[model samples]
Target chain A: MSEPNTREITYLEAVREALTQEMRRDPSVFLLGEDIGVYGGAFGVTRGMLEEFGPERVRDTPISEAAIAGAATGAALMGMRPVMEIMFMDFITIAMNQLVNQAAKIRFMFGGKASIPMVIRTPAGSGTGAAAQHCQSLEAWFINVPGIKVVAPATPYDAKGLLIAAIRDNNPVLFMEHKLLYRTKGPVPEELYSIPLGQAVVRREGRDATVLAYSVMVPRALEAAEQLSREGIELEVIDLRSLKPLDQATIVASVSKTGRVLIVHEAPRTGGFGGELAAVIAESEAFDYLDAPIRRLAGRDIPIPYNRTLERAAVPQVEDIVAAARALAQEGR
Target chain B: MTEFVPHPILDPAVIPRGSQQLLRELPKERLAWMLQKMCEIRYFEEKAEELYVRGLVHGTMHLSIGQEASSVGSIAALRPDDLIIHHHRGHGHTIAKGADLKRMMAEFLGKECGYCRGRGGSMHIADIPGGNLGATGVVGSGIPTAVGIALALQMRRSPQVLLAFFGDGAVNLGEFHEALNMAAIWKLPVVFICENNQYGMSGPAKVMCAVQPLSVRAIAYNMPGQTVDGNDVLAVYQVTQAAVERARRGEGPAFIENYTYRWRGHSKSDRNVYRTQAEIDEWKQRCPIARFKQLLIEAHVLTPEEVETIDAQAKMAIERAAEEALVCPEPSPENLEAEVYAP
Candidate 1:
């Protein structure tokens, strides 16, 4: 077949297209969340879906996160693919028992007789002035869970593809989206397509140093790589779309070739997903090729502040990634 | 707000308890089967307790000894195709729902022949084909799940109903209220059955709940709510039947709080520190099995000899199951990682 036609679309539009296309393709797939029906969701990611699929398919649930999560799990157990949205990542704490204890453990605890085919889509990271309660990156919490697969997409292309993969996968998936990436547009295919869950994408190719990033940090890492390229310091940017089933091969290959690594994320530095990536690289054969100590540039170990300056300071900016990669590349010399 | 008056349907002192008129109308064979099932549950729990004490069973097991009527009656009210979501103390509920006796025993014994392949011992037993969605160890965690199941059923316009069984402790959980309100607003075909066994672990219900009747809380969700004498099998059966019918008719969810008592302490570790012996004796005197048996005999539905024969048959079945479970092989570690996800 000829190459599929493509067009530019925002990350939010891509997410909606994926949901609409998947629901039309599969009758069992449905969406549920607080203000998802007529309200089109908190971030308008599910706009027009209610009218397209009607109220049954686009369920507007009560302001009960536990019920949304638990109900999705239950529906999944009963052979329905439910895509639930938790308006903000911070509110996920309320439904932790259902997602972590029940949904994550059901298949293993039930002797594998049941498979929970469900996806929880939520907006994460600190950029919007939503403050401490709303602005937080909590993907690290679910990455540690065994049965659940965590996916964080940076661009519209990956967002649509990865979400389709998540909806179709026979496992509970945590799909984390960056609030700032909603309006960001990218070239996306007109037709439906899916990117494999665990495969990492090489956004930019380089050999001087490797920068591992995901979600919002991906664009930032790419920006840093551009600036670093002018200074004659090349940085390979690897976007880990899937966290649980980590693309260790790509990570190892990049780290080995570059001989230096810098892990970046919008989450806190301590106990963040960056630490896990660092450990993975260190444990692999890539450790022997390390020219400098594996560095992790991440958000500070504090709640995201409301002030834009402080919020920017709390998380790693493009400049921070550039500086960290430049210093790591220089250390190799 | 309505006053917290105990539902008259649940009053123990109500006249015509286990109504002979109702018993007279029921088929003799059906009555015999119900009595037999209740006896089997009682005998199975007794044997399980013995096995636990003898160190044959590994983990702590929750026994539904005196609450057999509540388990049997509510389950008996549903069609075989109907679904049930159970709480931690759901062994009797499983048995009442017609789970294989040998497999259940093997599961408790951690044998490969168990329903969950020895993974989910007692608290997490499930029989999917048999319509038992399994039991949860977490209190009230399964309530919202049941609502979701009901929603799916409603969406498909299936004639089936889902019953979510939890204890009085679960009613106090936020999930319970959320699920009830959702089920009520959506008009999902579900029945929320609260087997109020008077205590939650070591805490008494009086101390935990603000309302006298837990069913009263259902009124806040705009659903029909009632309390029933849990020890009266017929009462529990009739109330559950009404709720099940209402759900089947698409009239929305209904809540039934069965007032019952557990004869044993919570799990194998309890020493009965929170309860008095006199209280236990008083509740035991209201034994559901004995009450049902007396009702059957007084109504001439079962002769004393037939009742003895049924008891003997149930005991024999339990013995055979225990023997089969004892000989079943332990799960091999070769495929330990299997079933963590769908293949």
Candidate 2:
């Protein structure tokens, strides 16, 4: 029972539309980051925002990532909703003190007297051969932090809706956008809407196995599921829009029906969000339904290489996901 | 070997111009009030130190013993609505911004009635309704936050300004430079006050910073900078007043380096092995409270008996606050998980 006014738009367009609509709707919301104003962001997600909102609201900051995160936190404490861009997700290490220590801990440390209502939007995942320093999927790092909400939107619809929800939330949210999904088009409604955080969507329901993924992995999982259907293997693909406050009920239900799970992500296999996902499934009622070990098709332990062939080899592609799912399905008869 | 030559701009004795003019123009009540507030801070810290010695206070505490004038004078120049963010040594800043003594004491005592409900003890005391954004234990962590608040003020076109208080130790921090540059370029309404207390824990300012006057770094950000005699209450007040006015007028951020001293070790665990007793004694002679008291007496702002009464009253107030705080209950375990996020 949704509206029928849907149009095809790229993921980047959806993100830009969400920012424009939120900034227009609320006076308390503003954007700040390096090269965001005149440069329109490194990826041009903020292009034309400077002309629409002017330089005061659309601020261009120095190349200091710490200041970008810290300033957004301070502004949020003063009752303004700030959406800051970190340029690249890997550079978040420079601003870790502000994001992890200050922004994440302020509200709790202050006994809830302060609310850091802010959003940090950064491009994540490995693709485009940006190398190790520029390309990374750091959502797991933020998901482990107690006081912050982590969101990784896969499609144009989730990107737009989740970005709006992140801006409206009363807690600090880390919105991770994949680098390669910027231009991918999907059917998106042209109205301002918010997809609630901590919800999962059943992209492709199946009975054989469940493929759990987020961000760019969702599309790849769907692609793998489609190809596996022709091979008589039915895979259920669930897109986890939010990492923290995870939609465990959906994941558990899918795993209970399929009796197997194949977790996929672009971050390294060691200590990635897939580990948390596997742990959540293992610790839940779905553990008894598992026929095989919860396999994770994730990026290799090595840093993302710059060469196209090695970069492609680092993270799981659609064929890798299909192969992993096929092997998991065939395990134990 | 090069002789230990002091830079001309870092000279601690160089007073600002129009000090006498500032003192003459100020009302007697205002001068007395400044003096009384400084006394309150001194007495509060003395009580806190006594409590720490008695094992009544937990955690490490940083005392701004000799920098009271720098905190009180600069805060006195701002409107009550203006915001402030302080560093770890922020008890004086909190009291100067008019936080209740009982709550502040309770915070140190780790009682539930404290400002942070006993969560943020000495280092993170805050009074949001009173416009104190809160203090941070991380060095130079609060600088960018001040810029952010100033940016919010500018975007909203609010008439309020923000004052960011940090130590000389924070000058070398990357965020400090980044924040100043952002504030300068955006012309945000903020005043960065560096309480140059001569030492960053054990490291001297001269060793930490290569520049002569720390305020001169403001030139890199294209903002006005000044160094004032921090012990002189009138001089600090005047310099801070001009900066606050410039911010209010939308001229941009200004940096003020108040050259002061810390009469005690950096923290409770410090052994004072970094400097000599003679050096400590030299800085002690320039005690902000004593100098401000002498100024008030000379200006006929308060009689010697009135000064004595103010001192006695501050002592009594601190004593009462400490006594009351000792009886407050600890936070309940039933609500241990509360307040992690907004309701």
The prediction achieving the highest TM-score against the true structure is 1
Tens-place lDDT per residue, model 2, B73-169, is 8999999899899989999999999999999999988889999989999999999999998999999999988888888888789999999999999
TM-score of each candidate?
0.97, 0.96
Measured by TM-score, how close is model 2 to the native structure?
A: 0.96
- Model 1, which residues run further than 4 Å from truth? A1-4, B1-18
Q: Count of backbone clashes for each model?
A: 0, 0
Residue A190 shift from truth in candidate 1, angstroms: 1.4
Question: Per-residue lDDT for A59-131 in model 2, tens only?
Answer: 8888989989888998899899999999999999999989888998898777679999999999998888889
Poorest lDDT segment (10 consecutive residues) of candidate 1 chain A: A1-10
TM (chain A) per model: 0.98, 0.98
**Tens digit of per-residue lDDT, candidate 1, span B129-210:** 8998989999998998887788889888899999999999998899888888888999999999999999999989989999
| Candidate 1 pairs with clashing backbones | none
| Stretches of model 2 off by over 4 angstroms after superposition | B1-19
